[model samples]
Target: MPDVQDCLPTALYRAAQVRELDARLIAAGTPGFELMQRAARAAWRALRRHWPQADEVTVLAGRGNNAGDGYLLAALAQRAGWRVRVLAVGDPAQLGGDAALACAEARAAGVAILPWSECAPLTGVLVDALLGTGLSGAVREPYAQAIRLLNASGQPVLAVDIPSGLCADTGRVLGVAVRAELTVTFIGLKLGLFCLDGPDHCGALAFADLQADPRLLATGVPAAQRLTGAGLPALAPRPRNGHKGLFGHVLVVGGDSGFGGAALLAAESCLRSGAGLVSLATRGEYVAALLARRPEVMARGVRSANEIQDLAAAADVLVLGPGIGQGAWARSLLSGLGALDKPQVWDADALNLLAAGQLTAPAGNWLVTPHPGEAARLLGTTTAAVQADRPAAALALARQLNALVVLKGLGSLVATPSGELYLCDRGHPAMAGAGLGDVLAGLLGALLAQGLTMTAAAQLGVWLHACAGERLGRAGRGLVAADLMTSIRDLLEEHSPCLK
Candidate 1:
């Protein structure tokens, strides 16, 4: 995804989670103001590195600690002989605690402090310190006007911590969010900044620990994780004596009457992704067509559940629901296949059926891939609600179904029942076409059959799929499902598991 970096000592955390951790660290003997100063230094370091030659800086300060970080960064910029100005959105008299201290520091550094007005000239690189993790509702009044101006200013922006008005847990924009060219987050990475609107709002993300004792984080659980190729564990190299049987069998059940292309896409993706054997269970009408298209796949068509029992029973990983309608045949096949104990990936109509309460997912070893609409159906909510807080929706779905959840979107989020959350920022808009979900299901299924853990398989599969889509998109539009197969194969070989 978006250029994965080395593992941050600080794992991703939600606003409340990080706030609690901050309190714990203070109770454990570190001063609150000290931590704030550390955060300021970290943000300042990042700002200098990103815009080394930009001497003029403008800071948009609010009432919260996020504003304090901005003021501190302004003070640092002033000390370094860069002309800096702080446009205070909050009454300076209302500032308290470390925020007040940061204000005094900025004033002492000879940085100009101006009260915010409708026509203030916000020049140079704008620093978004207007709001922080504590935001819960829509942006109001002067701040909204100020944010609107900052966005329209066209100057490069470096946000202190998260972008203003973005929910640190859900990545939802509270009416409006400041678009920063770069965001330097401290203490812990906010999970929201990497999902939903996160990737679009926060550009070129950087994380700093603020030198907090690592053990302090152990006291608080993470809200989510940002997946990186470097963070993924390596898959074993193919054994010299490996046989077709050792790689395991995959059963792809779907492709109802006019939708044969969906099932074929999944089956072909599985084959290309290294599944030793891939069997497609579809309408009998398409058997000849499937065989002619992909001869390597064992294409079998079935009219009833009994006809596909042996096939499902033989599979190590079951990829169900691509092109599956809610019709009698689709229901019969899914109902029969759900009884198997193998790891499974349920996508397309399978998810719709699950959401409709027509089918129950097996207890474990399953992944549910749903776009916002499908996820909303499964969660018994609306698509807006799902998109407003994707990270929460993903984790909630995972917990409710006891299955890994892959909520696909701008920044796809993968969540597990145990509360592990990952954001994949590696996809391109060209992947918005049909049949992509089927390909994802096949890739995930193939990885699972190869013995990767559910989380690992989901992570690797998402990374591979997104990276391939990005590469292919560079070749321009009208990419078909078949085009992904070759790109995926090439990417896997180039990536070589966890290496590089």
Candidate 2:
């Protein structure tokens, strides 16, 4: 079998959708108990492969089908000559259907079954089958206590599907959750495992398809698509006779006083990412400095909104925000952009100003990139609320503004006004730094200027930016925003080469 990472499916489904898929699979000739058996065998093989030296196994079983998988795994382990014991968190009398059958099989195989308690000793590899994707509320009772103990045990844990307390639809941790070193999931890939708190709790992820029919799987629509190299939109190769005029021009507007570097970073990123002509309209004080730093950019020191009118008129795409403060000068510049109907990428203070009600969202093809705080401001909610359900927040903002939204965070999302959603899981924690958003905004503008549609540009730009950070992140910390420009250029070339 291929490694989990090597064979990951592009489609991401909500928990309910996955359950529906499960039902559909069972209805299409596969029996429920047989599916459970397959799940157990898949997880068992993963556990042995991940920790071959372990001779003992402890199973934490609940009452549902998830528990059935655990009980069946215990039987397999016992039969293989490995010492195995099951700590039943849910009462055995409560189990019905296949779970009861699994328990009987475990007993027949001589697997020791014990009720869970605080005093029970945990040994060998711990299997967390306490809760599954069906959990919608906070964990309660002995299950919560069991999850807490599992987290504190310092034992290597392999979660049966998802970590017990993770919200499979949203990736939110419901009050408390078990942190597993390796999570072997079955059937479909849950959206929760790749976003928010999911990545932190699910350490090394593995997946098994359980031999579901591909044609049947295709009948269900996924909630979102994970961004991968296989089907990403790409720029067409440049013709040999292509000239600077053949590509479009991009104008970056922002940089209020002390925030000049932000606009410069955007302009530099735009130029390197293949914008034919990149210009910066900012405070006059930074013109000479911008020229000195990157002479390729046509840097202009604009004092008022009127100064940017000509630049905007000539530009094919505009990148707004990026250190544009919310003062008189920033307002003036924003006012100048009000009448322009060109495609734009809004970020940083531009989003802040919009959230502050300084201006109505312009009518045209545009994209807004907002972090969690900015997203909250735009949605008229708290940052915590936006973080709690990022996908919902992103879609809401996109629909409300009638524009594409790139909700930048751990699992960055690109949401279209039409309700299409794409997620980028390629970034690293080391990318948590300043000015990265600026680079992203600039790259987005360049892609738009080069003729990609709003949705296509947002998806490709986000993937390239995150992939660049992932590559640079391998060196550890101390990663600055400027470091991604070259890597992004390289990735863009690799994805869409200049020569055919």
Candidate 3:
């Protein structure tokens, strides 16, 4: 299990919440300057650790506390006799309080402070301290150009906190954002640094507590939970006396004719993930292929609705819509399955069908995983709108469908109908390939069959799937869904404790 250092708070607060925490800490006797100094030192330590040999450091300082952090970091570098320069992006005279003190300290340490200029010769490491999480609107004027130049510098950049033009509440980039190779965030873990463009812009992320009182931090609200593998639910190992029927059955519906691989992948996930009985109802043409791939799964080649009725009736869990296309045959099959009141995990075209108003989501324990575009369709909005506010969008879908909704993205959000929300930030970008969602749906269905509730199944399934992606992603690109199954079993084995 990974350390709980990443788990800060589940409630993502605005920039004001962080400020309030700072104020509360100061009010409780800790001097504001002391806290600022701690943050600077924390960032400096991370900087040195990340770029040990880089002697030249360009600190782009603004007029706020964030700049104070940059200035102090520059002072630390200068004191070490490293070639450090503070390219003040904002008016240096405008800096006040601890920030002003930090600037004076940097100057005293022989770190040259210069005004923002195109000819500043930004070489080596560029530290972005221009706009913090406080900025709400699009980055304007000189700052925007500065961000552009910093991005073009090709020098490995480090953002002081959140990236310059990213919304701290939502990971949405404020028009343009600086892409940092490393981002050292302080105080509390901001939610915006994990979702949307946050993952892309924040590169390798590091967090510091600034040695603030944990009690004061407890009083502060969290903006969002950072999902890792630490808090995942454990599936106990099967006992010697356990039988195949004890684990429950999972029925997958999809793969009309030519798209049989989708259903096969879903069934395979369920079969491998510990489902006692795994079955697939698909086109007859694919039956031999599915059996050839995994003989354990009971593959039924169903061309009509009648061929699936009995199977749907007996399924402990149903995985719907992985390549079930929107044709008449697909519609007829789903319509029949929708009438059955069983636990379901819907994905891919099934979600698309619901978004298109072709059918209503069936009642009972259900989980729906949709990407941003499908989520937008479900919410009757554009994909941009959905991406801008994913947390809200996930909640809305959960309420509308009366099911667990997993909004798939950088930080996958799982929202239950009961207003409960869970986040899974464990996957790698290599999992962005095809058949991944099918694998997720099958895993979730297997969990449901194994007696986990809709929410638990969804959350656990997401964590397992994402963690597998992260583990296998080390090989980089061209990660196939099948590669994750065995690795997932290995992880599950490490997680599950078996008593002799």
Candidate 4:
């Protein structure tokens, strides 16, 4: 239901924070059961809209307020004359507060209530109310079994509030989480719904306000911001008399031997994304081919670090580490960069070398782009650990490295050294290929050379890069990295035009 960008809340919250917001709303004159009722009504409306042809509904419920939502939905379905069944995963006798009241109402409405077992047959639209924001620790026993069975069921699933067994704050699956076709969340949008494993488990997202007071809802600071177009900081349009000298020069340093195309890809992105002057300091063998391919980029062959000195001095920014191998040659070029006072966008092998302790960040502006594997290596942990809590991992990388860090993957996170974070929820599954990071590295450098601060460059660059991928990704899978360059330039012009 995601509603619309303007209607959907821009800020994302932790599960605890959303729960706190709920408590605040309840304390401010709305009854708890009434809020539960609103959630049920909201969910019911969404369910009917999504599955209007379905005449039967299966509700999986637990013991908390989450289960209360299931019971309330069952009542709504029963009143509407839909054949409804409520399978209680948690004991009904243990229902407390609003949940017990909801159960009584459902029973009064003649909704069939049944105890859940491993073998219960699932049919029609299924509602997941087995767990909510209150979940922590791994799901145990019957709850785990229930989630497994729900996932195994092929019926269209609609998660109530949050998917059962999904961590509302981190989006981590607690051992296992219910996979739903559509997830409807209330009050505030939570972070777990956007990042890490959140996007995978949540089929499609819809948000509801439950008609809460706008003034009251604006109480606390949000956990992170969604990197939507409206929220992105603008790259001011260039003047009519803009010249190449006015915009900074960008030197792309990589393409070790066989990986020459990687460096060329980044250089192409830099030139296309409006970098004033783009240079390529790469393998000697590739110079002839690169000049033929992209003559706009000043191509040079630098066998040793010394060969790059003159080019590096004239450069305004460096796009480093696309296919830069970890051998003596790459190390020498890295050594050459150690003393340069220029902005740098590090990616690919640069991150890999950093993880291996072969190189340190050069003296100047810095932005590091790493996928989950690289991020894990940077943090000296496992990729699984990095993904489990993406926000924490992004922040840790930012603080530890003392640079602007972009942890690239699904729900890419851009974090500043000071701890500010932005989440990019855009992009497509077709981006699961190589050379994408190289394109991103060059784009970031181009933005930085155009005069955006390290943090702002990261945010805007990441948005443009992902938006480009999302555009071409619609053609389906097998998307090549180079396919995104033209779209990247177009999107950049659309957002922050060179000609106003």
By TM-score, highest first, what's the ranking?
A: 2, 4, 1, 3
Question: Per-prediction RMSD in angstroms?
Answer: 2.4, 1.7, 2.4, 2.0
TM-score, each model?
Answer: 0.93, 0.98, 0.93, 0.96
Off by over 4 Å in 1: 1-3, 7-10, 494-500
Highest-scoring model, TM-score: 2
Highest lDDT among the candidates is held by which one? 2
Q: What is the lDDT of residue 405 in candidate 2?
A: 96
Candidate 3 off by > 4 Å: 1-14, 497-500
Q: Candidate 4 has what TM-score?
A: 0.96
Q: Report the C-alpha lDDT of model 4 over 36-85, residue by residue, as the tens digit.
A: 99999999999988887988899999999999999999999999889899
What lDDT, from 0 to 1, does candidate 1 have? 0.86
Runs in model 2 lying further than 4 Å from the true structure: 1-6
> Over all chains combined, what TM-score does candidate 2 have?
0.98
- Residue range 1-500, candidate 2, lDDT tens digits: 11125368888999988999999998999999999999999999999999989999999999998999999999999999998999999999899999999999999999999999998988899999888999999999899999999899999999999999999988899999999999999888898898899999999989898989998889999989998876789899999999987788999999998999999999999988899999899998999998999999999988888888999999999999988999989888987585588999999999999999996788869899999999999999999999888888999999999999999998899999889989987889999999999999999999998989999999999999999998899899999999999999998988899899
Which pairs of residues have clashing backbones in candidate 4? Answer: 1-206, 2-206
Task: Order the candidates by lDDT, highest first.
Answer: 2, 4, 1, 3
Judged by lDDT relative to the true structure, which candidate is superior, 2 or 4?
2
Clashes of each: 1, 0, 6, 2
